[model samples]
Target: MSAAFFSATYGEARQRFLEAATRAGAAVGHHVHPLTGAAGEEIGTDTALLGPADAGKLFIVSSGTHGPEGFSGSACQLALLNDELARRAADRGIALLLIHAVNPFGFSHLKRTNEDNIDLNRNFNDFATPYPDNPVYEQIHDLLVPAAWPPSADNEERLNAAMARLAGQRNPGVSSGQDKHPDGLFYCGTAPAWSNRTIRSILRAHGTTRRHIAWIDVHTGLGPYGHGEKIFGRHSEETTRRAKAWWGSDLIVSTATESVSPRTVGHITGCAPEECPDAAITPTTLEYGTVPNPVVRRALRGEAWLAGHPDAPATLVREIRQAVRDAFYVDADDWKGMILGQFRSQALQTINGLAAEE
Candidate 1:
């Protein structure tokens, strides 16, 4: 059953991934995270590679760039490992790289950002240059992350009113990314996060020699429930045309007017060109929807509040964290089935596209 491949905790998920990698005869490796898990268990970003190391084509699937969102991504990776996809890729001489828990701290602790509260998705820019500005994010920062866990009714009313007036003006900072506020939502750090560095290193090692590479960075909590919205990972015309040809017309270019995701800078996939300059890359984010947009926003705000107020009551703490989890993961049998089914289909399409030239 699809539910069988899913796990209840990050520790359990990591263990299952390692065991499955061994069972599949994958070349396994680990980059240990500095912090322990929520249960005080060890934490790390694990990798498993199937097929020849020097394969000309590479297929990379990564999970947990947003912490709890890893639940669906991890399940998809686990399902792939146990399936016949590996053999098919190996037959085509395509190396399948499974990167588990790119943000181990967030994955283990149930927070979307890393230990430093940096949104790893927004933390992959070149640090030598000046960081991007988000003045609109500055305007709504106080409303988005109020002083209290559950903000007063008055605060909510004013925030809602402001949002209504500013509708279409810009995203409320959560999606656009920011650097001014360290504890704010979607905070892109002033420097490269460890997760950022580690993932880039992984790509440099496995992708440098590849002629063609396709990366699927699995995500959750956008679009309709249980539907995997394929967002083209890059903005360039060449990559955009190739992606549409491979993933079909259903693919959503994030820069489009009707896209679910906003056009944000410094995505995890943004590092690909710099690291794997020689390879032709087709990247996408397979985002599965869990809850509605408002619900997801509330959950994120509550979690951000909890981060600043660790002394919160245990009951309140549990409530906030549970909301965060539900926003990213729908732990039902049907949802698991949908996630696996969509991911599997995309994987097959990617494999076909990569093997077409061969």
Candidate 2:
């Protein structure tokens, strides 16, 4: 199917995906919560699950955990159900679970963070584990968030200096400028935000008692545009080997390696393995690249400016919204094709891996 045919707004995509799953004879479950955004938009996080309620092995494909990033993930999910691949998986006795719009407020507003401006991915630390503090983020936080809109050239220079010093062609697993500007980009959040809480609730609600669990949390930004990097959820050699064997060694990218991928910090995977301890949780992220990271960072900066400057001109807001969308979605047939094709292939690999294990 064409990507254009699958394109949908967050709510529309969720509705269509659920409908397709139901029509395919898959059981559905929903968790809804109300959220009032900074723009006064009443958005709700609606999570839907497909497949058997108590299946031994569950293959989870989740989208919109980062809001706007849902465009690709949602399309991939819808395409899987609408395509013949879903039937094949079902016939093999594999349960497919689609978690749509994990962060609805972010998806609705085209912002990366939830209504509370919290990066849900970074909000998943075990409460008992001390929240890792990024002291470097404190030093340059003010530079990232200027008092004026459209930061001055000097501000950009300062940001470049900070990036050069800390990130230096590599994300050091700690963001610079977090302590001073908690509201700025890469802000992990003061604590577990609503989106994080909601996802945890979903995991507890649907993830218990499963024998094997495979998760593909879709994301965009950070790597070569249009390619999906399969990042491992755990560092164990056994899990890494399993991921490579299942997804093809060439397709899997390890954060431990300096290859084309960058290191991640405070990721959601930390919780998945523990969430279903009884299950051999083989969690990995299928991160489809959008624009360059620097460009993405700049777009995020624009979003932050818009969120703060609510009175900004309508034209500027629209431009920023488009930029945000282009940064992730890349409205092109080839890009969407690559995303969907890889998504289906990986989903099948996961299902087959579980069935083989059985």
Candidate 3:
């Protein structure tokens, strides 16, 4: 059942994934994280590979890029393994790689960002060049991360006004990617984050020789409930056309008016083009909507406050933690079903697309 593929905690989800991969006869590799999980459980990025090491085509489904959002992505990956989708893809001469828990710290701690509070999606930019500046984010940093969990009404009003100004902007300062404020929302790190380097390393290891690579990075906290928004963010006209052809007209170009996400810099999917320069890269983020924008914003603000103030009351800490988790993961049977159905369709689409003639 779909519900069985999902789990309440990251540890349980990891265990289920490892077991499922084993049962599927996959070659597994674990990239252990230096930090421990919220419950003190071991956390790491796990990969299950199916198909020849020299396979020219690669299909990747990655879960847990946004911490608790991993619950849905993990479920999807588990469903794929359990349903023999991996085996099927391998049989078709396409390598199927299930990358579990790309951001294990956030996955285990229920935080959207990683251990360093860096948003992994926004942490993939080149450090040698000048970083992207967000003057608007700088102005609203104080308003976004207040000293208290329940921020003052004055702060809320000011923050809301700031958000209102950014309503239709291509890159909303808050979520776009920032480096000035370490404790602020969506802090793109000053340098390559551990997960950023890890992802690059993984890509170089498995994808350097591949002629074609398709990546489906799963995320949450945007759009309508249970809807998986297919987001493509690359700039190349050629790859963009290929992505459109594969994912269809419903695919949302991040820079387009139809996209629910921001036109942010430093996307994780960008790593593929850099790591595997010769491969034809087709990438999309499957962003599942769990809650409304305001609720998600509130949860992120509260969680950021909690991160800065470690001495807060236990009850308040629990409340903020649960809020952050809930904002990303909807722990209901119906939601799981929606996730499974949509994810399965996309997975099959990717397999068939890669299997098609050039």
Better of 1 and 2 by TM-score: 1
Residue clash pairs of candidate 2: 137-176, 137-177, 137-178
Candidates' TM-scores? 0.96, 0.89, 0.97
lDDT (Cα, tens digit) per residue for candidate 2, span 190-289 = 6777767767777777777788778889888757878888776436787777777788875555445544545545677667766677877788888888
- As a TM-score, model 2 comes out at 0.89
What is the clash count for each candidate, in the order shown? Answer: 0, 3, 0
Q: lDDT, candidate 1, residue 355? A: 90
**Which 10-residue window of candidate 1 scores lowest in summed lDDT?**
165-174
Local accuracy of candidate 3 as per-residue lDDT tens digits, 1-358: 7788899999999999999999988889899999899988889999999887789999999999889999999999999988866777888889988899999999998899888888888888888887688876777788889877698889989989998987777665457888888898888888888888888888888999999999999888899999999998856898878877778889988877778888788888888989999998899999988899989999999878887888999999889989999999998989888899999999988988898836
Alpha carbon lDDT at 64, candidate 2: 84
Stretches > 4 Å off in candidate 3: none
Clashing pairs in 1: none
| Local accuracy by lDDT, each model | 0.88, 0.72, 0.88
Write down the lDDT that model 1 would get. 0.88
